[model samples]
Every structure is written in C-alpha cells, then in structure tokens.
Target chain A: MENVATGEAQRAAELPMDNDAFAGFYERSARPLRAYLARVSGDAALADDLMQESYVRFLCAARSWDGEVAGRRYLFRIATNLLKDHWRRARSPSIEEIPEELFATSPDAARIESQFLLGPALAAMRPRDRQLLWLAYAEGYSHREIADVTGLASASIRLLLFRARRKIARLLREPEAEGRQGRAR
Target chain B: MIPKSCPRQSEVAAQVLRGQWPAGCVEDLRQHVNGCRACGELVLVMLAFQSARAQAVSGPAPVSAGVLWWRAQLRRRNAAVERIARPILGAQIFALVVTIAIAAILLVAQARNVPRWFSWLTQPGQSPGLHFEDLWSSALAMPVWGLMLLVFGLAAVAVLGGFVLFSDRPRQ
Candidate 1:
C-alpha cells in the first residue's frame, strides 16, 4: 500500500500542474462534485472536505485520463471510495439525521417542495440505492458512467435503477396516502 | 400511448434528463408520459429529484482553487520530508542504542575498578617508593589507542545527540 501510494505520488509529480488548467477544472466540477457528495453522504461539511480531497486525489491519481468527462467520472469514483472509507472508519448517521442545510436550504418553493419530498425518501433508502438514483436522475450519468463511478456492473444498473425508482415513488406516496386516510377518518 | 411496460423506459428517461431526446420524438414521448401513469410518475420524480439536487449543490464551494493548491503543495512537501527523514531517523536510533550500550559497559568496568583503586590509595606506607614511572607502567594504565577511542566515542555520541535533538525540533 505504501509503495502504491508512493508510486502514485511520483506519477502525480509527473502530471501537469498548470495552475490555469487546474483552476478551470475546479471551476467546472467543484459544485457538482460537492452536491453529489452532500447528497450521497447527507453531510455538507463532509462533502466539503471530501470535495477538496477528491480534487487533490484526482490531481494526484496515478493513471492519466483522456478528457474532462473521464476525469470527472474518475473524481466521482474517488469521492465514492472516500465515502466508503469514512463509513468503514466511523459509524455514519442515517439520512434522516442529516443536517437540514444539506437538502432543505433552497429558497425556491418548488425546489424546497421537491427536497422535502425527496430528502427523507432518499434518506430512507440504502446508500447504494440513493447513489444509483441520484447518478441516474440528478447527474444524468448513463448506465456506463454510473457503473464507472459506482463500481457496479453496467448490465445491472437499469434493473437496479428501476427498483430504486419504484421504492422512492412508494416512499414519496406513503405519507400522502396516510394523510388522506387520516383526513377521511 | 400507455403500454403496460415499454422496454425503452430507461433509455427515454435518460435521454430526457440529458436534454438529448430527438426533436421528432419529443411530442410522442410527451404523449406517452402524459398517458402512461407509471412513466409519468417516474419522469416527474426524476425531474423533481434532478432539480432538487441542482438546487442543493448550487451553493458556492467553501474553498477556492488556490487554497486547495496550497494545501496540496504542503502535503507534498511534508511527504517528501518524511521520505528523507525516515532512513536518517532509523540510523540515529540505531547509533543511540549502540552508544548507550557501549557507555553502559564502560561504566560497569569503571565501577569494578573503583573499589580496588580506593583500597590502594588508602594503604599507608605501601607506595612511598612507588614513582610516576611505576604508575605509568601499571596494568591500570590506559593505552594511547584506548584514550583516543574513548575520546572519539564520547565526541561522536555528543555530536550525534546534538544532531538528533536539533533535527527532531518541531518546525514552525
């Protein structure tokens, strides 16, 4: 592991460190990456930290990537692994326990409503399901891109995404159905 | 328009999200979404989820690129320092242990000689005829090479100690 880290560091040293190029990359990807981390982990602070780490690690990665899209996908992969490491090292809070600023801060009424409807529903689902759904819907990543970021089989994404969508729809509807039933009573 | 299950549901949804649906198919896709309850619900939820994620991430990043670059540089420098220091640290520790062991052996030998030397000194009228030449020829006399070794060992230990102490000091 140490050797691998060292070798990666050497490779990073050899990679371009042009400030202009890096700044451009950061400007393009930082916000989306932060949002992805925040949505997946449901922690803004952790997202912020992981955002920086992902960029740093991306710049320091041993392998070279071809284009911006590939680089961005690789960055997401690094962020996912970092999140997994965080989970392995420490017990993470459930989605419901995530701070409100992560999902509830938007001033737009429609956005707020969507977040209100989706946040808890997302929190209620497994992390992997949330990841798959978010990558599919939110990030607009295709099955292959999702597979790349998630380390999942590309063949399985469609089925998994379909299942996840159904689950989220059920979760979103359950409260309304209960409320209607209560009103009738 | 509302089939029970379209095989192209996932593909259509993905294309809609990407804003890449063909112009000719947009009307048909819209009709299908409006007519099909399951597809409509999926599209609605997916769009809502996408909007919510966009809003959630719309905030500015906490730190800028320059700061991140500075941190990366700092990390790289620290790693480089550690790489250089590791072997030196190992060597210093090894030298320390050997010096301590040699010093300990010398102390024990000197301790055994102390009582005999003291007894010899306290003996009355026993060394009146003993001269400086006799003392120089005595078995207790330290050889030139031995004296040089002791001096060199002490100096080496002191220099190494100082080097270790100075190098281990915390940097600002």
Candidate 2:
C-alpha cells in the first residue's frame, strides 16, 4: 500500500459529497480524533498529520455513513490503521510527545494539572496501554469496539486493559510518592 | 492510585462517559465511589481523560473542514485515475509481447530454410523463390524449419523491443 502522502499530496477536485455535510462531520470528529492519535502515537504532530489524512481516507472510503455511531467507529478504525502503518514503515520508533504546549491552551487549570500528570503516565506506558485507556475511558468505547479499532481480539481486551490500568496506576503512584517526600522534607 | 478496581468502577466510568454521573446515577453509587479507594482513583482518572477530551474537541482543527473535504475529493479522483490507468498499461505491455512473439516465429521459419541470398520478390524463372512448395524439398529439413523459426522469432523480439524502448523515451 502507498503511504499517507500518496493521495493527499495529489490534487483532487472530485466532490463526492456536499461541502456543508463534510464540514459538519469534520468539525465533530477532528479534535477528538486528533486527541486519540496524539495520545496513542505519543507524537502530537504525527497525530495532526494522521488526522487530516484519516478524514481524506474516510471520505474516500466506499462505505455508507448510514449509522452515525458506525461512522465514528469507521473514522477511528481508519486513523488506527494509518497510525499502525506509519509505525510499521518508520525506520526508527516515534518519540513520545505530550504536546505540553496544548496544556496552556486549555482554560481549565485543574484539568490541565491533572492532564500534566496523566500525560506522562500515558506516555510512559506501552502504546497499546495508552490506546486501551484512551479508547475505554476517554472515548468510552466498549471492549468489543476497542477490539475493532485496534485490530485486537475481543476476548483479550479485558485482560490487556486490566494489565494496562495496573501499569498506569503504578506509574502514577511514583510522582505522587515523590511529591509526598518533598512535602515532608 | 489504586492497582485494584471496585466492581462498580467500570459502571461508574460508563455513567461518567454517558454524562450521567453524580446526578443521573443513583445516590448509592455516588456514595460508594466516594468511599471506595479504587473507585475514587478511577473517578479521578476518568474525569481527567474526559477533560482532556474536552480540551481537544474544543481546540481548533489543524486544517479547515472545507479544505479537508476538498483534498479527500481530490484524493478519490486521483485514486480513480490510477485504478483506470493500471489495466490499460498492462494491456499495452501484453499486446506488445504477443506481437513480438508472432513476429519472431515468422522470422525464424523464413530464416532457417531460405538461402543466405533470399529475395522477397519471387524469381521470374528457375525454382520458385522459397515458396510453400519448398516445404517438402530435400534442402528444407524439419530441423531447418525449426531453426529458421527460432531466428525469425529473435528478430521479431529485437525489433519490437527496440520500438517499445524508443517509444517510451520522454520527449525533449
């Protein structure tokens, strides 16, 4: 298969859908999809690139958007596949990036502070761990849906998710423990 | 953070995701989440994820939706062009190969039996110039026919291959 740039780099003017209709879909799906890619791939820029390409592929896909929920799932599945393909084709592994710049953009101080902690823990965990947690709690996708998006078997999601939660819990505890020591000192 | 999970933790998370937490949920579940260590941690993490999602959703999209849609349209068009071009290119190559093969067979058969001084125009007198009548002649053995066919085939391939190579060259 060709890379993400194979098509996006080319000029296309074949309008397959109404402009306003696509705009609505893009507005609803873009940010959340970016967030999902950023956290899972640990590269915010790649997430952004991948997000744009995913929509392009999504629109180009032959399937119907009959079910709105199904459309969202299909979008995620496309993004996930693209991300995996990027990782597979890359000469070196992608570096983990939390996009600390984004934290300042958020007006909610409390949420930002919590995310500061969670981001690293997510970054420190394996790619699949971040994927499972983000999809499960962040997107609220069920185990079966997670299976569909990640291309993992449904039966293994629970055990894998359970292990992922435990790992994050351990990672989260360390900084808190350090903070407690610093406070006591 | 707790490594263990409360039985209702997933349930509480589901409620939170559905945006039905605390108010929509039964009072007992709220009390339990507050009291259970695992559930409390779960709540904190889930809320953080929710807030992060909110921030991302509210943030500006990297590219405008209109541009994205256009690019998607363009990409689809490009792919369609590629899909159509692929078979046409394949058929062109197949026809070229078949033409060369037929040319080679005819050339080789003519070469094997005909004398070094053969002419396309039939001679006015003497033995007919290498006509089909020569097929049973002593000079034209079966192996000679096969050899001639081989030579003719090679000539055809060379001629066709050269034509293809020259035709494919880019114009200055």
Candidate 3:
C-alpha cells in the first residue's frame, strides 16, 4: 500500500493542505457542529448520530482537501449537504414537540426552567432559521459567512436574522405559543 | 466615550446576545451596559438564556468502542489490499525480467551450439539431426519449462492466499 502519510500529506497540502493540523480544527469545530445539528434537529440523540457520521465523511474526503479557507468551507459545505439530506430522508419532528425529558435536570430550578422554555421555542423555528441562529450565536459566523454557508442572499441575512430573533423572543415570552406550559402570573 | 453612532443600549445588547453584532462592537456595548441598569439586567438575562440553551442542546457522548471498531475494520481492509497488490506487481515485473533473460540465454546457447567450431571442417554429408529443427525441439523439452511453471504456480497461490486472508467476513 502507498504510505498513509504520503496520501494524507498530498491531500492536506492541496488548498487547506495541512491535514496534520486538523487536531485543533476537530476540537474547535466538533462542538459547534454538534450544537448546530442539535438545534436544527431538535433531537439531541439524532444530532449526535449525524455529528459522528459527518466526521466520518470528513475523514474520507480529507485526501481531497484544496487548502485552508477552502478546506474549512468544504467541511461546512459537506456538513450542510448532509443535513439537507437528513431532512430530505427523514420527516423533521416539530421542535415544539420535543419531550421535556430531553433537557438536563439542573440543581437550580431556574436553570432547568429556562432550558425547558428555550428548547421548544428553538424547535418551532424553521431549520434554516435554527442554523442561522446557531451559526451566528454559537459558531460566530458573520452574516456574509452564514450567507455563503447556507446559499441564502447575503443582503437578506441581516433581515432574516432580525425576523428570527424577534420571532424567538416572542416565542420565548409566550408559554401559550409552546402549548406545553403556562406563563408565570 | 460612548459613540452616538451606536444603537440604543437595549437594542445593541439584544444584537450582541444574539451574536448579530461584530466582535469589535463588544467593547462599546460593554461601556453602555456598565452605566445602564436596565440594559445590564437585560444582558444578564440574555447571557443566562444562552448558557441554558447550550446546556440543554448538548449531544450525548461519543461511542468510542464503535468508532475504534470502524477504524480497525478500515485499516484491516486496506492492509489486505496492499499485501495482495504489492506481490502481484512484483511477480509480474520479475516474470518479465526472467522471461527476457531466459530468451536471451537460449538464443546465445543456440548461437554457440550451432557447431561454430566444426561447421567449416565438416563434409556436406554430416548427420541430418544436426539441423536447426533437431536443436529447437531438444531445447523445448528441457527442465527449465517445469521450473517456470512452478514459479508461476507459487506466485498465483501467494496472491490467492492474500485474497482469502484479507476478504471481509460477513458480520452476524
């Protein structure tokens, strides 16, 4: 067999050609990917499964990487495609319908209550909206970058975000909207 | 000094908490929230919301054993292909080289065995079996033919062994 080092190095040097430099990339990117998947799917277990599958696909495609910016873009591009495929193959569950038991029980009731409140509010939002929120808030992608990743109009990103936030805020503030709980008096 | 160019404290706090604002905007945002109690409280609530959301959405731990098993299976399959490919390539090259050498040796042997020493001195009525036909047929019956077959058979067996050893077993 040809040397794994030779194959990997050849692939790594192509564009974002530093395959050797992926340990840091993995650590930084994994959580963001997981978080993105979880929010979009509204199912932590499904998100975990997809995250692992996405990484396996990434490893398979590592030999074909072009360079740094392009490589990172490709990684996200693959992830987005996988997510789209998942949505296409499987019927998306209503985030509003995600079970209460999915949230962790914190010793602090306030923490648990806030989580319970936020989980389905996030779920009721569109998948693309969920992705936009997580990428902007958690992954720190700018509007233009999020635009590039999602293939949405760049100028529309700011507008879409404004709409998403306002909707989320309203959803969070109103328990009747979620149907699972009552607002405090 | 807080810039007049910035948005209202509450709006900017909302933007920052939503991660819509640029990272460079955080310093200006902090300055505004420091003096404004309402903005400070809103930012605290937003931060708390973020923390809770993060905690709630975190996925389960990875299955290390399953990942390891997958990697092991991939490596084994690759190793088996490599073992088989190397020797098959080597044997093909070796056979070509050996075939060329043997053909050259036989040509030289025929050239030297052509009665080069005695041909000039012999009468025209010499033994009929001394012709090229007799010499060519005798060379074909030599032990080298058997040796060549043995080499080829061994190479085939080695490749077959590699295939048998490396082929994946169907998991139950």
Best by lDDT: 2
Measured on C-alpha atoms, candidate 3 has an lDDT of 0.58
Residue A129 displacement in candidate 2 (angstroms): 0.8
lDDT by residue (tens digit), candidate 3, A1-185: 23553354343334222334555555556665666676666665677777777665665552555655655655666677777777656564643354443432223433433446666666556777777776665555677888888778998787676666656666766746644433331
Residue A92's lDDT in candidate 2: 36
| TM-scores of chain A in all candidate models | 0.73, 0.73, 0.65
How accurate locally is residue B61 in candidate 3, as Cα lDDT from 0 to 100?
A: 41
Runs in model 3 lying further than 4 Å from the true structure: A1-23, A63-74, A91-115, A178-185, B1-49, B52-172
Q: Candidate 3 docking category?
A: incorrect
lDDT of candidate 2 over A69-171, digit per residue (tens): 7788889999989977886676434423423233222234334445476765665566767788999888989989999998999988887887777656665
TM-score of chain A of 3: 0.65
Local distance difference test, per candidate?
A: 0.70, 0.71, 0.58
- What tens digits encode model 3's per-residue C-alpha lDDT throughout B14-43? 575666644646677668777765455444
> Candidates ranked by DockQ, best first?
2, 1, 3
lDDT of 1 by residue, B3-84 (tens): 2457657756776677564453567777776777678667766866777766766766558898877677666655655675
Error of 2 at A70 (Å): 1.2
User: TM-scores, in order shown?
Assistant: 0.68, 0.67, 0.49
Q: Could you tell me how far off, in angstroms, the CA of residue A90 lies in candidate 2 after the best superposition?
A: 4.2
Local accuracy of candidate 2 as per-residue lDDT tens digits, B8-68: 8778888888888768999999999879877776676677678778877887757898887
